[model samples]
Each structure stands twice: as structure tokens, then as C-alpha cells.
Target: MLLLFIPIGIMVHLAEQLGKMQDNEAPFNEIMVYLGNFSITIGNILLPIFLFLSVIFFTSKLASNTEIVAILSSGISYNRFLRPYLIGATFVAVFMFFMGMFIVPNASIGFNEFQFKYLKKGRQDRVTENIFNQLNERDFIYVSRFDPVRQIGYNFTMEHFDENNVMEYKLSAANIRWVPSDTLYRLTSYVKRSIKGEKEIVETKRRLDTIFPFQINDLTPVSYIAETKNLFELNTFIEDQKRKGASNINSYILVKYKRWSLPITAFILTLIAVAVSAQKRRGGMGVNLAFGILVAFIYIFFDRVFGTLAEQSGFSPLLAVIVPNLLFGFLAFYLLKQAKR
Candidate 1:
């Protein structure tokens, strides 16, 4: 565990330096502060998994070396030997779950802010493909592409509907910009047409300013766009979108569920580790280590696959987040049963 963290520390330092180079700015002390906080946050997030692996690796070696057999011959059941491991894993799992759900989210705000200032370097200030935002209770906006440098949107469309679910007005524009001074967004080089009672009124405008309830921060950034929000922020964002009547919220919902599920992976993997390596095999420590790594890789792969599906499909995010744990829990149970026999 001590050695594992050394590489993480090195990576954080390298990331900070890389940020400074990109922005042409001196390395700020604040960056180090954020890095330290972020590292701790990440460590907490991964601690359960580490604890699980540590328990399995050490205990498995003891069992392979005949220590477990000696203990079993002394009239102790294998389940009795698991008390310490389960206690430790439980503690770590609870810690990781709480930290991931409550603590890391807020810390990420600072972490991301530091990265944006020193590393991202105005890259996020611009908007790009598939921009979506909620305007009001009955209004929403979607744009195919936006160029912040030019303050123009390509294929911009705003939809407004009445309380009765009837289409009230729809506006399309080739380009749009925010007139900061007056707190208005101006659509330019565009045609404005409104439909009412099977009649359409079409007009051409050089510029039109309208009041909209969107801030720069309200726009999503391309990086860390998924699952970077804290519990409060995520809840608030969801409520805001719901109020604005936005349809798709599957991604955000998945992120919320994953915060709790990820920590439990540690405990489940630990059980699997102990079950896999408990038997005295001639292949020795090398074999146990290889098996451990393979299992870990498989677990990570399943996590990524489910995460991708949750975001893309209309599947329940809660189900997607918990499915890996559920599947592995069954595996662990099966292994434990086999080892006992």
C-alpha cells in the first residue's frame, strides 16, 4: 500500500507541472494544495479496494504455506478465520462509500477548478457539439455546435411549450451570442418565425436580444463532464433540469448511484481473492498473484462496460451501477462454498 501511493504522488506532481506549461503560468502553491486534497480524496475512494486486495493477498499466502491448514487442524473452521478480514473490509468499505458519496464531490470542485486554471487553459470556456441546457419550466435549448471564440452556434434550436403540452413557439438560429452588458443573448444573421393558429409570421433580423437564464458555468465541460458533481450539486442540478422539463437524465442518475456502489466492490473482491487462493496449490505465490491481477482486471472491465451502457441506453442507472457487485457477490459466494467443500 505504501509503495502503491508513491506513483500516485508522482503522477499528481507531473500533472501540475504539465498544467503550468500549458497555461504559461508559474506553478501556484494553490495547485499543490488542491493536488494534495485530490490525492487524499482519490486514496479514500480506492482504499476499500486496496484493503480488500491486501487481505486476500496476505491471507492467501498464509493458506498456501500451510498456516491455514495448521489452524484448521486445530479445530478452527475456515469461517472463524475470516472474522478479522471481514471486520477490516467492512470498516474500509463504509469509509470509502461515505467519502465517495459526500466528501469527494465537493473536493472535486476545487480540484477541477485548479486544473481549469492551470491546465485546461480556457479550453473549456468554449462550447462544442451537442449542447443542451434548460431555459425555464416550459422551455429548453439544444445546439448542434457552438464556438465560444466566435460566439456563434450552428443549428441552434429553442423549444417552448405551453402547460397543456401544446407547442407554443419554436425558434431556430444559425448563430447566437451573449451580450454581457445587458444580460441578454443575441441571435444574429437569423430568421425568426412563429406559428400560431395554422399561420406563420416570418421576419428577418440583423440582431435580437432576449432574456435567458443561463450562465457560463451552466454549460457542461467536455472533460469530467460525467460523475464529477457532488451529492448536493448533483441533486440540485437534477431538480433544476426537472423544473425546466428536460427529458433525459439517465447519465446524472447513474453517477449518483455509482458513488455508493463503487466502494462495495472492495469487499466483494476481497471475498473472491480469499476464496480463489485459499487452497494449497503447487504453482505458489506467482500463481496466486497472477490470478489476483486477472480478477481485478475483469472487475474493472465489467465496471466500465456497465457504466457505458448506463449512459447510452435507457437502462436504470441504479441497476447498472449495482449489477457488477451483484454478479461478483454471487461469484464470491460460489467460491466460498466450493472452498468449504
Candidate 2:
């Protein structure tokens, strides 16, 4: 298994570096940094799958060598042999679940930043013409133009509405820029107006810098805004987007659910592998490996199909994310029963 994975790892690493080089963006040192970070990210993502495949390969080899027969003859049930495997698989599943839910999200942010800088040529973070985002239940922000290159926003406006759905306060500025020294934003040519009941008040300032409690990363373009938020962040963002009446949150919702579902796939696919390869057949491991690959491919295909449908159609994100797992889980159980007989 190590022999098999070593070449695969080398290939993946080389491909990642080569792809970055082709982009002509980052220097070799920066590219190496990005490659290292990405390798760790992908490794975390694929570890459970690799472990599942390893179990199947080793278990099938043992069976092919008649070791399984020896154990069976010694009065040990097949189910008993599965105890250790189950324990190991459970550990892997739990580890993967937590990593996917927490660690991967944070790593993804750095990985994506690296990609944006070195491979995407900074295109990923670009914010162009007028952008509007509903920041909260009663507040919305608008920017006429934002230049990511300059890290500045122009013609910015923030409107705060009261519970009665009436605009209570409005702030407009000619420009806003992050003042890293103070860890706040500085707004220039700013005008602040307030209307309460029948009274109106206005305030103007040449330059105003305030500590905006929220990070810029926390606002606007809620979805596809940042790749570095954990499940908790993603859920919060999804709810915020939904509350803001955003229409393109389906994909994010699908991803949020799919993160939980993907780890369960290890158990489902492992069961399928055991069922397909448990009985000693005239055909060798090649046949079993081929069958495993085929099943894995089919599962992946349907997963993509459902995911795309969820985004394009009216399908529920939860169902779309989990249906493949459910279908294959049932199939695995059926095959396991057949193999037992």
C-alpha cells in the first residue's frame, strides 16, 4: 500500500507545482509554501478514503491467502474478525469528521489564499463594480466600487433600518480603507444622517476612522466569500444569507451537509468492498480492485449529479447531499448479507 501511495503522492505534488508554475504568478519559494500547505489539506481530505481502501486491500489479501479460512476453522465467526476493523474504522471516521468540520475549513482559507496569489493571479479576491450586501436583520451596505488591488472601497453607503422597517440612520462615504495601524477602517468625505419620529439630524466629517466590530471578511458576498470558515462559520453564513434573502446559498448549504456525509462514505464503501471481495473466487485481487474502483466511481458520479441538481433545481440540499450515501449504504448491507450466505 505504501508503494502504491508513494508514487501517487509524488504525482499529485508534482502536478500541483507544475500547475502553479504554468500560471506564472508566484515565485518558486512561495509556490513551494503553497504546495506544502495544499498537500496537507488534500491529505486530510483523502486520508479516510486511503485508510478504507487499505483495509479492503489487506483484508482481501488475507482471505486470498486462506488466512481467513484458518480463522474460520478455528471457530471464530466472520463477524468477530470484523470487530477490530470496525474499531479502527470508527476512529478514522471520527477523526475525519472532526477534521472536515473544523480543521479543513481553516486550512482551506490559507490554501485558497495561496492559490489566489500564485495561481489565480489575485482574481479570486477581486471585487469590482457596485456590491450590495445585507449585513444584518436591519442593516445593509453598498459600495459603488471596490478595488481589491488597492484594498479600498469607493462610494460606500450603510443603511440601518428600525424595527418598524423605517430607515433610521444612513452613512455615506466617498472612500474607505483599512488602517492596519489602528486595526480599523478610515472613511473619508463621510456624511451621517439620522431620522427619528419627526426630527432629522445630519453630521459630516472630513475623515472618520472607526473600529468596525466586524471584519470585512465577515460581510459581503457571504457565499464564496471565503474558503476558510469551519462548519460553524458556514452554518452561520448560510443562515445570514438566508435571512438576507440571498438566492445563491443552495451550493453552500449542500457543501455544509456534504462535509458530514463524506466521512460516512468510508464505512459504506468498506462494507461494499468486503461484500464484493469476501468470498475466495477464481478471479484474483485485480478483479476485486476493479470492482471497488467501479463502485467508487459510480458513487462519485451520483454524488456530483445530485449536488449539481440541488444547485440548479428545486431539490432539497440535505437530500441531494445524503441520497447517494443512503442508496449505497443500503446496497452495502444487501451485499453483505449475500456474502455471508
Candidate 3:
């Protein structure tokens, strides 16, 4: 199923992205990397649905053959008959926990970077205008505009305050560009003003190559930055961004919550699938498969809606991850009761 499904997904994506890739003359080797990352990201996202549908398919077949009836008739309680399925679900949940936490984030880096570099050339994936960040309690920075691809910001200002919230010095620059080769920041038209005793001491320079407390990415990270960090890195990154008072912090927290929620989702969908398909019916596997697909789409819909709300609005990210799983958990319980009867 993976061989067939993954190839089809790649074909569809390649069709849509081929024009942009060709126009940008994307290298064949780098394109291969993107396709590999695509496989990892897409497959991981679809893992729970695949598990649900596969279980329903096989279980429905067994039900049609009276295999499930034999097990129940042979003095095994319904709950005991469910033990193996539960064990299998436990294994899958653990596997998915590790995959979502450790493996997929690296693929996201390759995938998203290639997307912005080739298909979305000249379009910034990060915030690019009127950026502001509080580096620490006493230091703040601002920029009138930024160009992510060029790694430069215009009309940059850095201000420092004393313990009493009094202005100590202010630094302004016409432009700030990261000099990657030199490992330093180049500030053009640099000027500094020191305030003391109601007098201002001014200093100016044509250009200055120096270091600041913050990195370029600290200004406003790429929209998908959180998706590119592993579990450990993501937690640390979130805390750092929070300290900096990043305005889009919710989006990062949403990623963290979703990763943590995948295991619970696996268990919920597994139970629901077993409950729905373990009993023989007139329509057989076809009916079970169709219903499975419908439920899968509904799950996807709820997840997307809540995720968008959390990322765009002020809705809680934790609730966004939890609410859908809770709804499905209730459905599983109802279906399990009906199936037992």
C-alpha cells in the first residue's frame, strides 16, 4: 500500500510543482531530496488513517467469514477478543510517538527549504515587514522592513534601557546585513545616541561590522520553523522565543501540541475501527470501508479547522489538539457499546 500510495502522492505533487521548479531551474539532485522529504512528511501524517482503514478492512473480512463469531462463541468474552487488537494498537502508538517526535522534523527542514528556494522563489515564507522583537528585559529591536532571502533588514533600531526603565542608548542603522562568510553583521549608516543627565552624546559611522545579542532568525522566524525542529530542539526553541516575546508564539505551541497528540489519536482511531468492523453485516467490507473513509475525512476536517483557529486566532493550541480526539473518543465508546450488544 505504501509503495502504491506514496508514488501516487508524489506524482500528483510533482505535476503541480513541475512548472515552478522548471522555471527556476531547480537541480535534479536537490529535487530528489525534496521528493524524499515529501514521502516522509506525507506518510507520517497519514499513518493513523492507514492504520484505521487497514484494521477495518481485515476485521470486516474476518467478520464476514464468521471468524469473529467463532472466537466469541468459543467462551471468549468480547473484551478478551479485543485484547490482541489493543496490544497491536499499543505497538503502533509507540512507533508513531517516536516517529513524530524525532524523525519527521528533519524531513520538514529539507522539504520546506526546497519549497521556498525553488518553487516559491522571491516570495518570503517569513515575516518581512515592520518586525519587532524583545531580545531581553532591557533590550528591544525593530526593523521597518526585512528581506528574508537576502538576509537583510532596513531602518533597524536597537534600544537599551537601564534598571529604572530609563533610556541608556539608542542605535540606528540604515540597513543590517548578515555577512555569513565573515561571521559578523554589517550595519550601514550606523549611529548611536547616549542619554545622560538630560544631554545626548551622538556617534556615527559609515558602516560597522559587529555582533548583537540576537540572530537574524530571532526577528521573526519562518512560518514553518517549528515544524523543522525535533522534540528536544522544539521545546528549547519555544522557551527561547517566548522569552523574546515573539508575537506568533501560538503557532509554535500548536506544533508541539499536535506532535504530543498523535499517540492518543492512534489509540482512538484504532478502537473506533475495531468497534465499527468487528461485527458481520449484510453489506460486508464495502460498507465498513466507506464508513471508515467518511470518518477519516471528518477527523481531518475537525483537525484542520481547530489548527487554523489556533494558529490564526487566539484560540488555545492545547484545546485545538485535544477537542477532536475527545469527540472521537466519545464516538468510540458509543460504537463499542453498540457492537457488544
Ranking by TM-score: 3, 2, 1
Q: Clash number for every model?
A: 0, 0, 0
> What are the lDDT scores of the predictions, listed in order?
0.72, 0.75, 0.93
Pairs of residues at least 3 apart in sequence or in different chains that clash in candidate 2: none
lDDT by residue (132-223, candidate 2, tens digit) is 77767788887887766556888989999998889999999998888777888999999999998899999999999886645654344523
Question: Which ten residues in a row are the worst by lDDT in model 1?
Answer: 217-226
Model 1 residue 147 CA deviation in Å = 3.4
Q: What CA RMSD would you report for each candidate?
A: 4.0, 3.5, 1.4
Candidate 1: tens digits of C-alpha lDDT, residues 1-341: 73587467758677657646445663567756776666866676556556656766797689777998898889998899777767877777787777786777777767776766666666663347788876776777888877765555667678888888777777877767767778778886666667788998877777678866675435444345444576677788777755655445676777778776765777787788788878888887778778777777787788779878877887778888788889999999999999888
Question: Which candidate do you rate higher for lDDT, 1 or 3?
Answer: 3
Structural similarity to truth (TM-score) of each candidate: 0.77, 0.81, 0.96
Task: Report the C-alpha displacement of residue 132, candidate 3, in angstroms.
Answer: 0.9
Off by over 4 Å in 1: 6-26, 41-45, 64-67, 113-127, 130-137, 148-157, 170-175, 179-210, 216-223, 239-248, 279-284, 313-316
Winner of 2 and 3 under lDDT: 3
Q: Give the TM-score of candidate 3.
A: 0.96
